[model samples]
Target chain A: MPQIAQIAETYASQIFWLLVTFGFVFFVIGLDMVPKIEATVGARDDKIAGDLATAKAAFARADEIEADYRKRDADARSSAQHLIAESKAKAAKETEAKIKATDAVVATKIAAAEAEIKAASTSAMAEIEAVAADAAREMVAKISGASVTPEAAQQAVKAALVHG
Target chain B: MHQFAIEPLFGTDHLAIGGYNIAFTNSALWMVATVVVLWIFMLGGMKRELVPGRWQAAVETMTGFISNLLTANVGPEGKRYVPYVFSLFMFILLANLLGLLPLGLVGLHPFTFTSHFTATGVLAIMSFAIVLIVGFYKHKLHFFSLFVPHGTPVPMIPFIFLIELVSFMVRPFSLGLRLFVAMTAGHVLLKVLAGFVINSTNAGAGFGLTVGLSSFALMIGISALEMLVAVIQAYVFALLTSLYINDAVNLH
Candidate 1:
């Protein structure tokens, strides 16, 4: 084979060129290019991890804010309910006291009115008895032709009103 | 045989260095071509995009494959040798595949330098040299213990060590010969099949239709197989180099 036959002649050149070319590849590619590629990959991984951590922190912050908002909402609702209950109780107590005072005033007024009516009715009854007695005495004198005294007339009217 | 012949380029056959014929040959041309192609391939990776384009991804994939291979075989210390092994792997791989390029249709013959034992022998020696340098530098005389197993019977130790020592010494020769023989054989088979097709076609229409057509089909299949072999041989070379480095690094 020529591979065997030409080896003595070609080995030197082949080795020389192989070293030169292979050395270029080793320095330019392996030493220079590889590290750059690895760095880029490593940087991307770091950036991804950083972004993920940021997102996680933001998510946790949002959860905390939501919890705080819910707690404040519950506090406001309970306080408003307490205020409403306090106002209702105060208004009800004020209403009960006012009603009791009005009731006492009305009762006093009604008692005064009943006393005035009794006094007026007693005077009217006396006037009505005097008239009836005067009429009775005139009728007695006219039939028998006898004069009647005023006092006797009052006494007779009183006895008749009492008997009736 | 002509494919494998070393013809001087630019009429440099008259060139000499010291007493040796240092004529720039087709093999040297292919070696330079391999470097140029490799540099162009590596240019994609220099773009340094976090989101790599397809070209960059291809570059990264090859580097990553070698990087991972070294890491697995030789552990963390293998990281220091990535450049040498990467250069070795890509050089041999490109040489092997470039040789199989179907450029013959355009009246160009591609030489597979790896088919020459001298070229592969030098590569194998480089790897073997690294192993020796690392093993001795790290372990001193303990590196000799690599030839002896932990559970060896004292009586059998001498024989076992002899076998291991011989096998260890055979690594470079076997490594170089494997690649050279594999590449040369495939090319030879393809050339022989091509001869069959051509000869049968010249014989007559009946033979051409049968024998030539069958050989042509067979050549196509074998060409594809050669492509696979080209890749496999490159990987095997790099993998064995890493494993051998492992033995030196780990002393087992």
Candidate 2:
């Protein structure tokens, strides 16, 4: 009851100061402090979100670069394969050409040898015919006790050579 | 008992201005102390470091806590009242806790501001004013329909409306009285218990010592409980304010 009685005497002063203190607090906290705090929180959140976005972008860029590198690597590998295949095909073609050139040279050499052998055989035949004629004439003369004609012997050799 | 007394600090009588007394009193001094401490706590705690320091974290936590409270109670519209609500909560909380400090040094008499009806009553009325202002501004005449229950029978409407009106009118008084009574009662009980300890110790030394020890222990326990009550009462006061504002804004 005394406390209650004291309230009347004390309330005006209490409220006067309460209002002053509260007004100061309301403006200080409500207007000044709270907004700053809210802003800090907002800014922190934004920073985090921005950092995450940057990280995500970096990841995406890395993935793209990796893909590009893989593609280039595949291209290089395929080009190398193509070069190897092309060189192999060229080598095979050159080998075939060399073998053909060798075969042509062998064929030419065989023809030349054949021509030389023909000439030699022809000369030997001619000489043999001459000797045969001389011997034939000598034999005929000895048998018949008469000289043989050269012109007739020579013609007979030619006829015999042509038939052989 | 002398702790609760209000003697003018400046003059023989309270200074008057425009037919209103504005003399500074014990209650006013403590109220100013609460405000100053609140300012220091809030401003000092805000460094806004990416990873906050202890004080910054405290400030941020309090801000977030009040934001959540408003969101839960008053929805997004409650965002407008964050400063007011935050101030109210801090004012009561600091007032309660600061009272527990041994501020009576040399010749200074420290008092608990929230324990006074004038302080709590003004806060309660201000809270009610927000509800009324917001309710009427948003809902106009439909604000009065807050008393109308959704499924009430027509015959029972008058009775129910009367009950609702009475309850509605008593919100401010209840808010004020609850904080005032709880704070006053707790302090008074502590004082009385302290008196008992002194009285028992002044008796014959042997019996007195035993009684003094036990009573002092009980006092310590109760004081701890009172600290809890102090925090709880601050929370309840703010929570009820938000709830009242919710009822006004949402009319539910």
Candidate 3:
């Protein structure tokens, strides 16, 4: 039979690391989690603030555009009277120009919103992919004892997505 | 080659490493295997499919187990910490059970399963403690002050600090010992019983075969018992870890 005392002596160090790893894990959870949550909250706060700022600026821009439209519209109205007495073409051209300018600004804002949403979605998906791949690497090592390359993980992810 | 001895070499007076007794050791190899296995167990089935396949489902169960644990102990604020807690449970559980596999990823050859305290195991516990310490540091002075109990007299400061220090120091020991003892005891029991079966079979009575059959039956029963012990020990380790963190974080 092997000596128990000898086993203890030899294993003392192994025993030490196990305890160490255990503590690190719990430590990460207990400590890092709170700040992560705070960061999330902070991000949300910054987003809300940005949104409010953007809306305020948009309102200011819209006000200027409306004032310009009204001025141009009144000018067109006065020109229309002249057209009735003279030529209608100039009044119609002024109205057309005002409509085009307002439509351009609205379209620009729509495109920007779309771009922002697409960017956010793309980043979120990529983050998900990375995390899933990491978890897969670990699992494959445990279950199959095979080292999987990143390309393989991507393939596995693709396969999962197909089935999913 | 001679038949392999199921028993491990625990200690040797002849071999010395750093003035401490040394034996041909194999536990570290098993730890590497455990780490690899743990990585697999955690990462496998992580496709996050709405309707998970078998592998994913099994992994999800473990994930859910850890997630639920963090949620329960640390509250909603700590739910995000599920990854760490689950990873911890998996590491401890896998390491504890690696020895039981007759030919787990790598067979328990003489190079492994031999007795020697390995730093890998110590790494597990120390890493755990360091995480807590770091967490405490992250939480800053508020966390350090946790060592002092509220409403205590000013005279009790040093005494309290000493008690808390000793308690924190023992955290790894308690965590490692619980897992180590459970595993070692279970395997030793299995070995001793197998020895009994061998000895009884060789005793050469008319009823030797009958005795062997009974012993074999007992061995089967013991295997089942060990399986339960394995899971229980894992739970105990994880639960204690959560409690320790709760104390550190909330500082109650």
Q: For model 1, how does the per-residue alpha-carbon lDDT over B107-194 read when each residue is reduced to its tens digit?
A: 9989999999888998999899999999999999999999999999999999999999999999999999999999999999999999
Please compute DockQ, using alpha carbons, for every candidate against the native two-chain complex.
0.49, 0.42, 0.08
Q: Rank the candidates by DockQ, best first.
A: 1, 2, 3
lDDT of every predicted structure (CA atoms): 0.89, 0.87, 0.62
How much of the true A–B contact set does each candidate keep? 0.77, 0.67, 0.19
Candidates sorted by lDDT, best first: 1, 2, 3
Return the TM-scores of chain A for each candidate in numbered order.
0.62, 0.57, 0.38
Task: Please tell me how candidate 1 rates in CAPRI terms.
Answer: acceptable
Question: Which RMSD values do the candidates have, in order?
Answer: 5.9, 6.2, 44.4
Residue range with the least summed lDDT across 10 consecutive positions in model 2 chain A = A1-10
Q: Residues B1-252, candidate 2, lDDT per residue (tens digit)?
A: 767787777743648766667788777888888998999999865676787888898899888888899999989988888888989998899999998775565666668878788889999999999889999999999998899889999999999999999999999999999999998898888888888888988886875689888888999999898899899999999899999989888998
Residue B171 lDDT (model 1) = 100
Candidate 1 at residue A74, lDDT? 100
TM-score of each: 0.79, 0.78, 0.51
